[model samples]
Target: MQDTVRRILTARVYDVAEETPLDGLQRLSARLDRPVLLKREDLQPVFSFKIRGAYNRIAQLTEAELARGVICASAGNHAQGVALAAARRGTTATIVMPTTTPGIKVAAVKARGGNVVLHGDEFDQAAAHARRLEAETGAVFIHPFDDPDVIAGQGTVGLEILRQHPDPIEAVFVPIGGGGLAAGMAAIIRFLRPEAKIIGVEPVDAPTMKTALDKGEVVTLNEVGLFADGVAVRRAGDLTFALCRDLLDGIVLVDTDAICAAVKDVFDDVRAVAEPAGALALAGLKSWAADHPGSGTLIAVNSGANLNFDRLRHVAERAEIGEGAEALLAVTLKEDRDDYSRFLTLLDGRSVTEFNYRWSDVGTARFFVGVALKNGPAEKDALIARLIAAGYAVEDMSDNEAAKLHVRHMVGGRAQGLAHERVLRFAFPERPGAFLRFLASLKPAWTLTLFHYRNHGDDVGRVLAGISVRPEEQPALTEALGALGYPYVDETDNPAIRLFLDGARAGS
Candidate 1:
C-alpha cells in the first residue's frame, strides 16, 4: 500500500495529463439540496482520465522498452491515451481495437500517430490479438488498468480532488471500468480523507467490479453491454480488484437510461456533453442521494467527453425517462374519438412527448404513449391509476428493456396472420459491409417477416428483426443466427410486441 502511495505521489503524468479542476455543479447542487462537485477529468489533454495512467506507465518504461514501442487493446479512450502518450515520448503505439469501436475514437487514435488495428467484434477478442502481436513484436504490453504505475497515475485524480476541496465530503463517486480509476482514487481518498466515502459506479449490464466484490473473487462475465463502451469490461482487473475490494465503500450499478440522464444532467449543470461512461459516477451519485437525502457534500468524476456526435439523439430520448421525468405506456382504449378525448382530459394537460396510434382492430385499439412527469414516479402512477379507472388497460413500458430499446420506435398495428414468428434484437457492429455480411449469412428458407432499426449514433447498432419459420425449423434458425456472428436477444415474449395482442395472437 505504501509503495503504491509513493508511486502515486510521484506519478509522471504531468508530461501530458493535466490536474483537472474540481468544479462546482450549481444546478445539480441546488436540485439535490447539497453542494455537488465534479472532478473535470474530461478536461484532460486526451479528454479523459486514461491520459494520466497511460502517460505515467509509458514514462516509466525502460529505454529498451520504449525503443521497442508499446501495444494495447482498448475500446476507445485508453487507446487514444496510449497513442497521445507514446507520440509525446517519441515512440510508436499499436492499438488493437474492436471493429465495433466508434469511428470518432478510431480517428482520434490515428490522428495521434498510433498504428491502428481493427480486429474482431469485441474487446476480449481484440485483447487476445494484441497479446499475440505483443509477443511477436517484443513491444511493451500496456494493460488498461491492472498495472501499479497506471493505477497510481489514475490515483492522481484523487489527489487533485483532495487538494482542491479540503473540506470533508459525504461521498466521492468514481466510475469503475476495469477498476484502475476507482482503485487508484479509492487508495488515495482512504489515506488522505478517511472521512470521505469512496463509491464506485458501473453500468448495470457491466457490473464487473461489483460482481467480483459480491463473490469475493475476480470472475469473468460471459457478456457485457456496450452502450457505455468506455467501461464495457467483461472482466475486472486483478490488482485493481483487490485494491477496490479493500478501499471503496461500495459499488453502484446503473442502467443505460440513468447514465443518459446523467449525461443530460451534466449538460444542464455545466453545459458539457459527457459521454455515457463519463457521466456514470454522477448517475450513481444521483441514485445514492435519492435514497440517502441530505445536505451533505457529494462529488462525481466527469471522466470524459468523447461521445460521438450522432449518439446525442439516443441520450436525449432516454434522458427524461432516466431522470424519472417521463413515462411511456402501452394503453388499450375503445376505438372512439370520445375515448381519446377522455384520455387527454385525464392527463390534466401534462405534456405529451409522444403519441403513436393507427387503427389495428375494429373495437379496440392499442396506443403507445409518452407523457411528461413533473413529480416523477408518483405522478406516473397516479396517471396510470386514472387511466385504469376510466376503463382503459395500461401497461407501464418505461422500465421494459425491449419496450424502451425497440418497440416504442416501431409502433403500429400488428400483422393479422403472422405465424411462427420470432422477434429478436441484435447488436450490429457499425462498419462498412457489416449489414451486407449479415444478410449474406442468413438462410433463404426462412422469411424475414419484420425488420426495424434506428441508428443511435453508436458503434453498435440496435436492430429488431422478426423471422418466420416452421416449428421443425427452429434448430436451423438458431444455427443460422449464430453463424451471423452478432450478439442478439430473443424478444418474442416481450409485452412490447403488439404481435402478442388479441387479434394477432388469435390468428396464429
Candidate 2:
C-alpha cells in the first residue's frame, strides 16, 4: 500500500495529462434530490483519463525500452492515450485494434502519429494478436490495466478528487473497463477516505468486473455488446479485478438506454457530449441515488468524450426513454376516422412523440405510438390505464428492447401468407460496401423480407432483417447465417416483434 501510494504521488502523467475540474451537475442534483458533481476527466488531452496511465507507463521506460517501441491493443480511448503519450515521448506506438473499432477512433490514433493495425473482430482477439506480435518483435507490451505502475498512474485521479473536494462525499462512482480506473482509484480512496464509498459501474451486457466479483474469480465472457465500446471488455484484468474486489464498495450494472440517458444528463448539465462509456458512472450514480434517496453529495467521473458525431442520433432517440420522459405503446383501436381523435382525447393533450399507422381497410387497426411524459413512469402507467378503460387495447413497449430499437421506426406492416418467415437482427462493422456485401451474402433460396436499417452514428451497422423460406430450407438457412461471420439474434419469438407481426386484418 505504501509503495502504491508513493508510486501514485510520484506518477509522471502531468507531462501529457491535465488535472481536470470537479464540476457540479445542476439539473441532476435537483432531480436526484442530492448534490451531484462530475469529475471531468473527459477534459484531458486525449479526452480521457487513459492518458494518465498511458503516459506514466511510458515515462518509466528505459531508453532501451523506448527504443524497442510500445505496442498495445485497445478498442478506442486507450489507443488514443497511448498514441499521444508515445508521440510526446518522441516515439511511435503501434496500436492493434479490433476491426469493429469505430472509424473515428481508428482515425484519431493515426492522427496522433500511431501506426494502426486493424486485427480480429473484437478486443480480446486483437489483444491476443498484439501479445503474439509483441513476443515476436520484442516490443514492450503496455497492458491497459493489469500492470502495477499503470494502476498507480490511474490512482492520480483519486488523488485529485480528494484534493479538490475534501468535504464529505457519500460516494464516488467510477467506470470500469478492464478495471484500470476503478482499481487504481479504489485503492487510493479506500486508503485515504475510509468513510467515502468507492463504487464501480459496468454495462450490464459486459459485466467484466461485476461477474468476477460475483464468481470470486476472473471469467471470460463469450460475447459483449458494442454499444459502449470503450468499456466493452470480455475479461477483467487480473490485478484490477483483485483490487476492485477488495476495495470497491459495490458495482452497479446499467443498460444501454440508461447510459444514453446519462449522456443526455451530462449534456443537459455540462453541455458536453460524453461517449457512452464516459457517462457510464453517472448512469450508475442515478441508479444509486434513486434507490437510496437523500441529500448526500455524490460524484461520478466522466471518463471520456470521444463520441462520433453520427452516434448522437441514437443517443437522442433513446435518451427520452432512458430518462423516462417518453413512452412507447402498441395500441389497437376501431378502424374509423374518429378513432385517433378519440385516442387523442384520452391522452388529454400530452405531446405525442411518434405515431405510426399503416392504412388498412379493416374493422380494427394497430398503431405504434410514442407519447411524451412529464411524470415519467407514473404518468405513463396512468395513460395506459386510461386507454384500456376507453376500450383501446394497449401494450407498453417502453421496456421492450426490440420494441424501442426497431418498432418505433418499423412503419406498420402486416405480412400475409409468408411461410417460414424468420425475423433476425444483426450487427457488423460499418465500412464502404459493407451493407451491399451483407446483402450479397444472403442465400439464393431464401427470400429477404422486412429489412430495416438506419445509421445510428456508430462504427457498427445494425440491421433488422426478415427472411422467408420453405420448411425444408430451415437447416440450410440456419447454416448460412452462421457462415456470415457476424453475430445475430433470432427475433422471431420476441414479444415486441410477435405483437406487431401477428395477424392484422387489413383490406378486409
Candidate 3:
C-alpha cells in the first residue's frame, strides 16, 4: 500500500496555481540571526492546502466508484475541499461533522455543495457516524489522511515545496492532527530529498502523532483539547503512523499561545489570519529554528485557515505570553507579599500584565501573578534578583506548565463568575496606586464580596466589587455609596446580576 502511494504521488495529477511567497521575517530572523520563511498556504483556494489531497484522492476514483458517490467526515476545510472537488468532478459528496462544529464551517461545506450532516460531539464520533452511513448507503469512504490515496495526494505538497524553493531545503515543518498530512509529506520528502529534514507539528494539548512516535505505534489520548479544533485528533491513523515512524525527522509540540502568536505575526506581516492548525507549522519552525539553523533552507506549510472570528479573543489572550510580551507568575508565602511588592516596584518601567489572587493552602499563603514586559530577559532577571535580594522565593511561572495551563485559568483559586450577596462596584484611574488605594479604603471589618478588575496596564480601570451586606443596610448603603469618588451602580437591581451575586453570598 505504501509502495502504491509512493508511485501515485510521484505521478502528480494536479498542480498548485501559484507557489507561496517565502521571505525572511525581519523581527524573528533578527532575533535568531537566521533566515525564516513562511509558506502562505492560508492564501490557497478554500483558505487551506487541504485542496491538494482532496482533489488528488477524488480525481483518482473510477467512474463506477464515482457513480456510487463518496462519504467523509471533517470539521471544516477538508469538508469544503471534498465537496468542491466532487462538484467539479460531477459527483456527489456527503460530509459528516460534529454537532459542535462552528457555523462558519458548516456554511463553507454547504457553499461547496456538500450534503452536510452534524453528528456527535467530536471528530472521531463524526467519523464513526460517517462510516455507518457509508456502509448503509454503499458510498465510497474517503479517509482524510489514513488511506494510500489520501496520503499520496497529500505528498504532492512536499513536491511543491521542493519545486518552490530553489535552495537545498534544510527543514520542512508540517502540521499533524491524525498524521495523514505529516506522514504522507514526510515519506515523500524523505524519498526525494533525504537530507531535507521533515518535522511534524502537533498541538501540545493534543499530541496524537507525538504519542504514536513515542510508543512506536498509534495510541488514543484519554482526553484531547480542542483549542486547535482543526487538528485536535486523539489518535493518529495507522498508515500515517507507519510512515511517520519510519520517515519523519522530529516532532514539535506547540502550545495554544505559540500558535496564537504565529497567527498574530502572520496577520501583522501579511494581513492573513491563520487558523490554529494553519499556524502550527510556523510555530514549529519558530520553536526549533534557533538550534537547527543552516541545514540549508527552512520551509513551513500553513495547512488550513478555517477559523472562527469570535475565537480571536481567546487567541489574543494567549498571544501576549507566547511572544514573551507577558510573563505568568505564581508566588508563595504571605510574608513575602511586602518583599514581592518592593521587587515589583523596582521593575519601574515594566507593568503587571495580569494578576489574580485567590486563597490557597499549600502550607503557605500564595498568589499567582502575570507581568508584562516591554523589554526582554533583562527586566525578568532584574525582578528575580530583587525578589531574591528581599529574601523571597520566586517561581518563574513563565516556564511552569501547571501555572500556564491550570493555574492561570484557575485564577483567584476560584472561578470568576461565582457569586455572593453584595457587589461593591468601583471605578478608579487605572494607575499603580489605584488598587492599593482601594484596598486601603475598604474596611477589613466587612466580609469580602466578589472582586473583579481588568488591568490592561492602562490609566483607568473598571472594577466590580461584591461584598456581604446586612439586609437592613442595603438600601441606605446603595443611596450613600456615591460619596466615594467613583460612581457605583447597584447591580442587585439587575435580575441576572442579582441571581449571580446572591449565589456568591458566602455561607456562614
Against the true structure, candidate 1 reaches a TM-score of 0.81
lDDT of each candidate versus the true structure: 0.87, 0.85, 0.73
**Which stretches in model 2 have alpha-carbon errors above 4 Å?**
413-508
Clashing pairs in 1: none
Task: Estimate, for each residue in 1-508, the C-alpha lDDT of model 1 and write its tens digit.
Answer: 6777888999999988887888899998988899999999899877899999999999998888899999999998999999999999989999999998989899999999999999988788899999999999999999999999999999999999999998879999999999999999998889988889999999999999999999999999999999999998888999999999999999999999999999999998889999999999999999999989888899999999888999998899899999999899988877655565677668887755556554533677677787889889999999999999888999999999899888886664475665787878888886544545665665666655554544444778777667668899999889988988799998887776754432356434
**What local lDDT does model 3 show for residue 139?**
92
**Candidate 2 lDDT for residue 502:** 40
lDDT of candidate model 2 versus the reference: 0.85
**Candidate with the greatest lDDT versus the true structure:** 1
Q: Each model's TM-score, in the order given?
A: 0.81, 0.82, 0.78
lDDT against true structure, model 3:
0.73
* Positional deviation of residue 369's Cα in model 2 after best superposition, in angstroms: 0.7
Cα distance off (Å), candidate 3, residue 123 = 2.6
Which pairs clash in the backbone of model 2?
A: 310-457, 311-457
Clashes of each: 0, 2, 14
Per-residue lDDT of model 3, residues 308-394, tens digit only = 899887788778778777766565544333443455565564656555544333434455666777665566777777766766677
Candidate 2 global TM-score: 0.82
